[model samples]
Target: MIKVAFVFGFRNENWLGGINYYRNLISAIKSLPDRKIDPVILIGTRGSEDLLRDFPQLEVVKTTLLDRRHPSWFFRKLLYRISGRDIVFEKFLIKNGVSVLSHHHPLGKRARVPVMGWIPDFQHKHLPELFSEIELKSRDKWYGEIASQCSRIIVSSDHARKDLEKYFQVEARRISVLKFVVDYPKDLDLLDRAALEEKFSFEGGYFHLPNQFWQHKNHEIVVDALKILKDKGQKVVVLATGNTVDYRKKDHFNWLCKKIEEAGVADGFRILGVVSYGDLVSLMVHSAAVINPSRFEGWSTTVEEAKTLDKPVILSRIEVHQEQAPKNALYFDPKNASELADCISKALLCDTRGKGGGFPLNDLAVSNNFAQRIAFANEFQEAVLAAAYPQEKVHSPML
Candidate 1:
């Protein structure tokens, strides 16, 4: 059994992309060729016991992230280094003869166990303003170190894989993109679009955009573009769904609100504060056209999820979207709203062709079709497990 330990030691729910990626991976790995490959998930205080309800088969081990600011943190790190507190990791790796990690930030420098690190996006490097000054510098340094130490790098899209090659300078061949997998249920009873509109007070012609209100997300540009649409006598209700909550220690959220107020399109633009996962999915499905305004992305899960949901997406003409989205998605200049307005018009005129709501698991799932996803999970883990302990595996016939 290849013992694979996926790290989830951070608060995952808040970071939606990471949460979905790890969840899909662990679930897929559970039904592999060799059930012997035991997968242990290491998580921190963030995730809920509800995750088990979401995916009952997954095995998880909970632990908290060390407080770097705490007085004991420095000493704990030191003790962790010398005493090699990788006891749990070591036992699992040695006993199973291999272990693989599914996240990027290494908890420590122990590389005796082979790791396949996942770098979801390189947004901070491409669009520096989206991140705080200190954060950009810290991320670049950390990614460089993480890239150097890992056995292989996994990315969500070809766009990100190329970014890693350019900025991180990792070999092109070392990076692989599994493509973002969609978790749309097979039996999707899409809600009545009319009913959702009534419930959410979106009876008017509303444009549903579910993206974080980051500068890189280019939310300001979209709101401004909607202004143009309104000026032209187009009463488009731009129903945006995202957490504009004050998560950032900075006043960026306040600035975003200010931008909306400045546009004077507050009446046309409604920022539906954070919605639940299921509701978010339904929002994407029911919307007239899902819009992605991100200036940069490793791969836009919003776009991917929208594509899988089989809804038309009007996304920024960025490399990430071009690389992953089905060619039919309407593209617009990331910086220019006139171009975006043109796209919005064209998108509205276009007919809906795909089944509404559910990962177009049929079209863009790549290698992760239901059965193939499970099969690929085992293959991916076995490669890592075999690489981790090349010596023992050769001695054991069963291996």
Candidate 2:
């Protein structure tokens, strides 16, 4: 079997996009035809254990290097460079028969194994103001080195693939646009909308903004739009849920709250901080519509989740969001609060009368979308197999 190790070493921060992306990926890969490939997740001791609880059936390997900030990280990084691989990590992989390493960061140049590096987006280049000078330099250097070193790079959207080629001069063929796939349970319809609303203390007719409070996510614009609505004597309630911290601007969330209070629209906007996966989905299922007003995205998990559930979404007209083209999405300019205010007002009006939310669930559409995702995953697996054993034809049948 072709054994590919997926390393999960994300920092325990407010953002859940990285975790959600890999979770869906693991789920989709597991559903592929049996005996084609074996996937293993390598994680650290600290922040990763709780995140992977949903994946109890997955094969997990715990290690220290997964924590980049660990006390011994310096020594381990030096060891990797000295020998092209960490001795302990190499041994663990060999004992488990691992052939390839797929991680969010670039692997050491000395390692003989083929790596699939993931660069989610070039947001720092696009929105430089959101990052400090040190972070800007780090992002440029890290992405450039990874593009030059990795056997192949994985991006979430074709827009990202184009950006990689244009800015980093990475070859188009070297990049794979593996758009994310949402893997919802078959019994999603069985969820009681009323119970979900009651559990979250949310009314049935509130717009949902289920995005982290990252600066670039443009939460401020949503609040500004609510101010516009309030001025016009239109009271629209927006329920926002996500991590309430922004590492770049530590006080960004506090600033947003202050703005809401100053605008005298605190009652119109609700901030529901970090919630469980079940509660998050419950909020979505019962909301009037989901909204994403981000200035940039590689591929939005919010849009994917809305599409899977056949719910309405109001998204900012960024290039990547436009590329995603969610089925039931309405677009608006991110900078214009009036445009978004118009969108929210209209969506709520349409949603209140059961016009947009009454569409019958189409199981075939969901299954077809999922099949396309599995096919893409299979193509990626084929590439990994070719790198591991170039002499053999490892192309498996389509799903």
Candidate 3:
């Protein structure tokens, strides 16, 4: 079996999306029929045991090398500077017989094993005002290194691939577009929707806005939409849940709170911040519809989750969202509050829930989801193989 290693070090709650991304991707890898690729996670000593438990089927190696606070990481950095190669880490991977490293930062040009660098999006390029000059330069430099040094680059969407080529001038031949598919929990049907709604204090039908309180998420538009609904005597309620902390914009959540207060739509919005994953999924599954007002996205995990459940999504009409093209979806201009308000008003009339408060999938839809999961795994395996054996002619998946 071809062994592929993924570094797991994101422990911060603010990066819950990143954590879930790896979890879903690894789960997809494990679902491959042939099982030709062996997925391994090289986690730090401080890595979450909960995360480790999520990957019971794969090999997990705990090492000090991945821990940022550990001295060995500093030594690895020094070694990279001195010899123009991550010699210590390279030797460690070689010792472990890792054929390729995926979804991590670039090692060095002189490293032995093949590296597949993943750039989720060009958020900094598109929203430069949100980042400091140092951060901008750092991201640009790092992306440049990934494009130049890595054997293959993995991007989430065709939109990101275009951005990578347009800005970094990376050749299309070396880039792979691997659209990830979500694997929902089996117990979704078991969740008591009424109990969850009562626990979360939902009075009636509510729209779910699960995007984090980041500036680019464009939460203000949603607040504006809520205000419009309230003024029209509409008893609409929106339940927002996500990490309230944005390290770049420290006061963003506070500002959103202030905006809600000023707009006089506080009664219409329930900002339940940083909820458990189970609760998040429960909220999504029980809501009238899921909403994503983000001005930009790589490939929205929220959108994917809604699609997996076959739930209706009222999304911002961004390029990537169009590319995602969920079957049961409504599109609106990201900047237009009235348009979103109209969509919300329309969605309130639809009954998406079934018995037990879940949107039950039909047999054909279930089969299609399984097929898509297999396709995701196959495309990911092909990318790994291409990175490991560039000489072989492996057809790149369609953008």
lDDT of each: 0.66, 0.79, 0.86
TM-score-best of 1 and 2: 2
Q: Clashes in model 1: which pairs?
A: 1-36, 308-360
Using TM-score as the measure, what is the rank order of every candidate, best first? 3, 2, 1
Model 3, 58-139: lDDT tens digits are: 7889889888858998998888899888889999999999999998777887689889999999999888999999999999
RMSD of each: 4.7, 2.6, 2.4
Instruction: Using TM-score as the measure, name the better of candidate 1 and candidate 3.
Output: 3
Q: Which pairs of residues collide in candidate 2?
A: none
Best by TM-score: 3
Top-lDDT candidate index: 3
Q: How well does candidate 1 match the true structure in TM-score terms? A: 0.81
Query: Which scores higher on lDDT, 1 or 3?
Result: 3
> lDDT tens string, model 2, 128-161?
9989999999999899878988877888888888
* Model 2: per-residue Cα lDDT at residue 368: 76
